[model samples]
Target: MGDQIELNRRYIPRLPSQTQTQSKRKGAGARTWLVVSKLGQVSVEELGKQTVMRRTGITAHDLRVVEPELSYPAAVLRRERAVVVNLEHVKAIVTAEEVLVPNPRDPRIASFVYDLEFKLSADFSATMTREKAMEQLPTDTPPEASGSRREAKMRYSKPLPFEFRALEICLQSVCKSLESETSTLEEEAYPTLDQLSAKTSTNNLKRVRVIKGRLVSLTGRVQKVRNEFEHILDDDMDMAQMYLTDKLATLQHEGVSEDEMDDDADVILLGTDINENMSSKCSTLFASDLKPNVEELEMLVGSYFVEIEGILNKLSTEYVHDTEDYINIVLDDKQNQLLRMGLVISTASFMITVAIVAIGFLSINIRIPLFDFGTYTQWYEAFGGCVVCSVFLYIMAVLVFKFLGLLG
Candidate 1:
């Protein structure tokens, strides 16, 4: 009986440890996303690549541009149904009515996610309140009150589209991040450069080098973002494409078939006809109020472009390069002084060596006429003569160096 029990126990599988099970669950959750919509609805789900592609109606290639591991450049690609944004540290897919951000739990993006949700919710509530107030307005108002009503309606009705609001938030976040980093860099760089000027040291040099490298990197990023914005601003079609919400609303109101709407590229190709139809549909009273859709996006992007331009100017290499040049001049002066001192020492050493050789001959055991004639007194006088000659030679060497302009 005991042997049978032991065999059964050996065949049975052991369960995984509690920690291992928890870690597996945690890894699974990391791939999940927190999706937010303009209606203030929030849902958490494990959104795979195919699921996101299906949800946003974007191609796999567009989706991959915002993938966390790809390290893609700052881009804002307008797709058939989605706007793929891959700005610094903020990667998201924005559609007409919804936004899908991967890894929303990451500390880097958590604040953005929270802010987006709050703003959307607030906008929704404010919109509801505004609609209710409009409905409550009396139909038999006086002429002056009617005018005020028209003004109020105009003011309240022109809220930015959902996508533009989201884009605005993203731009604001990126700008704030850049501004903060720039401020920090300036703080660190200015003091370090100044200290380096006052007194050069290994540590201070390393700090300045790091600061300059940071400045160069920041400048590149700012320039890249500016170029992307410029590219969109220069192309009217690109800006129009970014108005995903407006296009969808227009197409739906025009009774466009689902098949036609599915391929936004074709819709865009036929935008001229659609725009005329939209213009005709507008009431004559409000027709004058209608503006080009691209105008809003242009103004939006242009404002940030100006902000980024200012940042780029702040990161100018003029100050850094000038400081570097000054440091080089100081270093060169010190090096030249070292070289001149070494030359002076070498010349004195050579003169002293010559004097030593002359005195050394007297110490030789070989017979010499001078040695035979010299007593101790003569020996002392000869030694004094050699010392005097050495002094003279050293002075002559210094004079030659001065004449050649090497002493300076």
Candidate 2:
């Protein structure tokens, strides 16, 4: 019986602790994401890693870059169908038709959502209005009517692709955030630096140190963002891949000829076709080009790059960094002045010590000829002579120090 019990104990599996179970659940948790589309509607949904991969056509490694918990550097990666953005606080996946933002309830991200809805819906409304006007025109219209349409078309500006619009919002939000932070830091930093320069104290030094640290961190982040922009600008192919709408249209045009076999293959194709059909009558619709052009995206990114560069310059060398250098120079000069003053005082102390030693020796009971003169006049003479000798020694020390160029 004992042997059987021992065998049973060894064979049975051990259950994990409650803490371990909870940690596992948290690690593999489902996250909520906000889906914003051209319709100007925002929908909240819970999604897992697998679901995100399936929706975005990205791998697990690419998805990890945008995870909010991870401390990944600024990146703008273009996948086959989506653009992954991880700039500072904005973590999102932008597709040709919509954008998926994680943690939409976050206060930092609220502005992005608002801008996306307002701008995208407004563009869609404008496009719809233009299409409707064109559709109402007569098929056998006269030359004058066509001329009016052409004039109206010329007056209307072209709307950017949906992907570009979403990307633009993200860049704008990041740049705006950076600028606001730089301004706030400047307001606090300049005063602190000025106060420190005027009066060096423990409290003021601490404040300057803290401000400098923050500026350094901010500069690094700005540099990373700028580098990402430059990386995209340098590679034409990378920018070309970012043209999701154009690529979708090209794929759709090809799909009609080859007869896509799988039903799943037609999902994006059908969506693109429906969108193309709706805007076909509009004169400003983006046409399908045989070769992809990146000029549009290049111009967009280049503008933001300039903006970010301005912000970085403010943090790096224009304002805070320059102030720090000036403060250092001021502090060094003050230190030298203090040292010289101390040296002068030390010389005066040495001269006083010699006078004090002579006076002490005469006051002793064993004094000989110096105390022989009993009158108070002799005492006064001795005191005056000590004072005169001390003054002479101090003046000589001052002249020597000045000659050595140590008292400047």
Candidate 3:
């Protein structure tokens, strides 16, 4: 029994506890609840209040106690051996990683960290090995590994599961924070590349979820837009399939006419008297029509054929042009994102350079005829002035770019 207990304890995850009660309600009486769950099978409710109290280092009495002096009603609840935090004081739940917000009322809000979780899977180690091998393997090794080989492979293995798990948790925290904000945005709310690039938040809001046997990020709001577009594309394909089916049915019904049959054909010879009479009439009509049909019929058919071809050509050209336009639009968006990223990097580099220059400048002592500027105090003041100017310029440039719609 003791050994079993130890084994179970070894697998149990360590819980990190943090508690914050709202002192006051801010903006629209918004209440944010942070829910932690595992595989949707476990909820906070399953975890008893006592367990939470133990994990969080809060006394059992605190769970039952109420603090009316605190501005908001807050409590911790356990579900499925996990903790749930209910907060009525938070105006927004931002991710712990950087999130790009347009036209934020307060810049300081950008730094707000969100709590989230990351799930680490055992398959990641194998995936890493496969990726590394692909990058550095010899020509003799197969590009793809078989299931048996994958199971047996242990090259470059490292025993850092704990570290990897911790890192995964940290990443998860970032993803969750980003996801909260993204969920609030509409599907069509595509941030421009510039906006995405200019975003300097350290919080990441996303979670890794397994779907259809694939691991995918479940955080960003942009994924909804992608799904919406995919749905639209599927609908279009369905419509096209229905249209083609209708066209095929019409073509099947309007196949070759009886009058076009040969005089001594097997079809006519094998038929009954009624069919024979019909065949005879069709043959007579065809013989009479054949001579007169040559000139006028050919010209009419030729003219219609030309018009049909012209229409087809026009449609093909339009389709090509539209496809090209779509490609160009996508390329332009990519280019814009790259441009914005470059700008941000350039700005950061410039600021860093200014800082370095100011440090060097401050370290120097200057002696002037009009004034004695040789003192460290004077140098410090000059460095401070330079720093202030540099910061001012950075702000101005950012604002200018934003105003020009070059920065989001």
Candidate 4:
């Protein structure tokens, strides 16, 4: 009797004392409940209560939220348990982890992220008991059978199962990566509007390329999320995820052949044809329930989407404008400097021309000082003076230009 009691205690999961459960709930400041189940028949929004209608049919994808008070890590024993008893609820808890961002410090990480995770229903652990099997056996059943049953019970221990932690951990990691990006953009790497109004430099040019690349990356992340949601939503049949556990139970109660389950291909074919018939009902209910939620999430992300859009648009616009103005300023300065050099060269040319004309007259028999001070000198001397004056004029022009810091 002692051994039997010990065995039962080891196999069966114990319930927490009621007092402890109440005290734990009281201490926990806030709680969030999400509907993880996807039975087309059940909806929290439609029902409007803490209670969800219990349905026997459940899947791993149906886990909704992680209860803060629940010691989720301790409960989940993946190695020990082949299948969770209420695995759908466990999956809901897993889904909850991915859907909500625990710490939403960065606005760039959209309000929520959601994705479907599928597990093989066929792989679930066996729930049928040895007691039930024995009741159906004949009185002549061998003693060895009981020994085998005990050995099987000892070997296959039931695990204390809850939500899988990996899903949330992965999503949170991505969000953290996103938050870092957003924070970097909002703070250090990007310049403010006022700084942008300042002179453009090589540094600004570098920043332009970096900002553009960042914009592209962020856009890709958001789009990827959008595509995921759309892919699920577009198929009304898949979106409904109607697991008719009760209906199947009812059918079983009506004496349907047990062999029907083994013929999977036929079941799938029949289900597809029936699904086609029931499409309208499922689609209507699913669309009505899901569209608002998807849209609401999109709406929350809508602001951030617009924000990224605005940032990209703003960055592109400013980059072009600043670059254009910088190029224009540089070109204008070059043009003016060229004109200054031309004016100086032209003045020197004019002086040289005047001297040549005077020398030409002196060369002809007009042996006179070009600017007479009432004295006569040799024609060669006057000519020599004219040549010196022209050379001097050219040198002076070069010096003046150099002094003004314009020629270079």
Candidate 5:
């Protein structure tokens, strides 16, 4: 259970430490904390029994939640949950699952499908902003008393310090989850590609579309995540915003000398000795004041983001090839059926031709009863009889073949 929980079932609660001036605050820690390296970014989080693993106000994502509503043993882990962290924007809506529905291209999915899900596309600034004390303040809470918001939802969870090895463990867990899912799909959908039948061609195609569509959606999601991290890494201002806790802390420690209510307030004289330089002191604070090169964070999540994307891409390719194979097999089957029907039709034509040949013999010059031989009237009577007999034999033979189920 612990192993399963760590691989992909782990979730970090939105903590108060993440939003406050101190990473050591009682609660409100960012679910992940980043450490940068030349190789890539690292994310680390510590999980323990007392850790705040579940809560509201943040999305829950993991494998069990993705599977159907069937019961699963409550997952618990004894080790402190530690996962390497980075600021990447890879988020996919939790895909749902349900009872069996055989699809040529995918395994059975959840009966109830959800339409809306958030993407992990937040830029560095937005990501940092989300981690800020100001952002964590509930809408009903005033900015002046923002500390109360952190206090209300505080927890005792520990932060996994930025470490490369720890990050690897976290990433491996995610990879494991993805690998398991891909393997399941291979077993459920890809194996029978060659065995698909003509009767279910349309259904197979529909199922294939569902699977391919999911992969395509995942590709876009992974790309967006990679792009988000890159955007922050390239921009200094974006990086500075990630120091949200520090900036807010600085403002609080300095105390708003200007009108605290309106940051846009014009310079007002608190004392005659005050010079123009002192006016609107808060405005003097700029992105330059916030250091962008904080070694505390590294956005190295793109590597794994792309890796997962590659997996999804590979799955999509397999599905495409399988769909084509199934379709080709179905078409071949239809063609064979058509060929057999053509042979049946030719056989019917031959039977009619034989009947015509047998009737033609009666029209040839020969003696006949109750008529003068070689007279025009006798010849006309023979010709009429020949036509009647030929028509009757052809119709009878067709009816007999149809009745015997041979002409279908």
Candidate 6:
């Protein structure tokens, strides 16, 4: 009976098998997945346990968190083609629609779409639709409705079309994060000219402009796709100015915090001084604080250089052709002068020969009382020497005039 009891104990129904227990434990530890989609297409899968992104058949590192004060794991992802950042890390999200309107600050008019899902610990997930994402709200609103306003505000001022504006805003956020992070790194984390030049079919001409004080550096390719969409008008120009004003305000706020942390008011004071100086300079140069579109400004400068080059080429060609014609005319005049001189020399030589022959004939035909061979020969030689010297002097004068550029 005891043996039977032992067997029954071993086969108890209350306890599971070792294998079954192990399988259950493994299943419990399995990580949850969050689907991140753009325009109804899955772009990335976020692993809950690892807090890492899995995309394009590859797994990347966890994004770096800048501000840990937020409730979520807000981070900045710096990738090869784009930057990805969670909006939760942002201190504040401000939307200035006044900058977008026609009469005020003309911001780049764009349409945007966004769809974000929040997955909680209890397998409960809620999604914010594109329509909800487009609405601008006060800072105290619930997280479920905000929909990346911090990132969206940076790129656009007005409502955009679904999916299109979302992608652009995301891209712009990524670029801003990259610029901010790279400014702190000691070594270059991006591609160099050598690497960029060697790649095939690489769009190397594109660049990202990083503004620090008065200096700007182009760090990434200005996407050709974005260029196709950028059309600036007076409204856009006004919007750009407003954007700059908004950025300055944000910078001042952040800078004040940093200054407080450092216990040094010098940074803020210097910043103010610089601002005053810049304002004065801008007024002197541009006559207004309204900023121009940088891309349009660059295009204008490039067009000016091209036009100047064309004008210079035309002028150079005309000058060269006219110079050649003038040279040809001068050369013809020199040739005529040489021909005239030769004709005079030939006539003088003929006359001297005749004179010599006549003198000889007169000596043979009639004996003159005072005439002698030696004296007559001497006079003939002297006259011949004078004619030769005169010809040499005339040739030298022509050469001098030619050297002085008087002939041409």
Q: Which stretches of candidate 5 lie over 4 Å from their true place?
A: 1-180, 194-236, 249-286, 289-291, 294-298, 319-323, 329-408
**Residue 24 miss distance in model 4 (angstroms):** 40
Candidate achieving higher TM-score, 2 or 4: 2
The weakest ten consecutive residues by lDDT in model 5 span: 93-102
> In order, what is each prediction's RMSD in angstroms?
13.8, 14.0, 36.9, 20.8, 19.3, 26.4
| lDDT minimum window of 10 residues, candidate 1 | 7-16
Q: Select the stronger candidate by TM-score from 2 and 3.
A: 2
What is the RMSD, in Å, between candidate 6 and the native fold over all Cα? 26.4
How do the residues 169-251 of candidate 1 rate in per-residue lDDT, one tens digit apiece?
78878888888889999988988999999998899899988888899899899889888878888877667667776655554
Model 1 ranges off by over 4 Å = 1-31, 138-147, 259-292, 357-374
Which of the two, 1 or 5, has more lDDT? Answer: 1
Residues 1-408, candidate 6: write the lDDT tens digits.
244224322211122255334423425322222233322232222122211221110022222232222243333232211233343212111121100001011121111112122111111111233324445445675787567666665544443322222323433443344344444431331332223333322243232112121121222222221221232222334233323223323334434332231222222223322233223332333334355544533343234334333333432334334533654566677687787677556655665565556556555654333555333555455556655765565566556756876544
Relative to the true structure, how large is the alpha-carbon lDDT of every model?
Answer: 0.73, 0.73, 0.35, 0.39, 0.39, 0.33
1 against 6, candidate with superior TM-score: 1
lDDT per residue (tens digit) for residues 1-408 in model 3: 244224323222243342112211222322222222211111212233333333322233433332222333333222111222222211221111111111123333223222222222233445455557655644454647554354444553433322222222333333334444433331212232223234422221111111201212222222332332233233322212212112222322444232222222223223323244323443333344322312322333234334333333432334334433654676688789999989977996898698878777666555442464354565557778878888888888888989999976
- In model 3, the Cα lDDT at residue 159 comes to 31
**Candidate 1 to native Cα RMSD, angstroms:** 13.8
List, residue by residue over 1-408, the lDDT tens digit for candidate 2: 244224323221232365334423424656778887755567887666655654565557777888878898899998656899999988999877678888788898888878877887787778777666666656776887988767766665466787898899999999999999999998998889779867878899899989988988988888999999999998876787787766556555444222221222234323332123222311122343334478889899999999999998888655556666777888898899999999999999999999988877765633355557555665567777888999999999999999999998
lDDT of 3 at 235: 38
Per-model TM values vs. the true structure: 0.78, 0.75, 0.23, 0.32, 0.36, 0.22
Give the range where candidate 3 is weakest over 10 consecutive residues by summed lDDT: 204-213
TM-score of 2: 0.75
Model 2 clash pairs are: none
Candidate 4 residue spans exceeding 4 A from truth: 1-179, 182-281, 284-331, 346-408
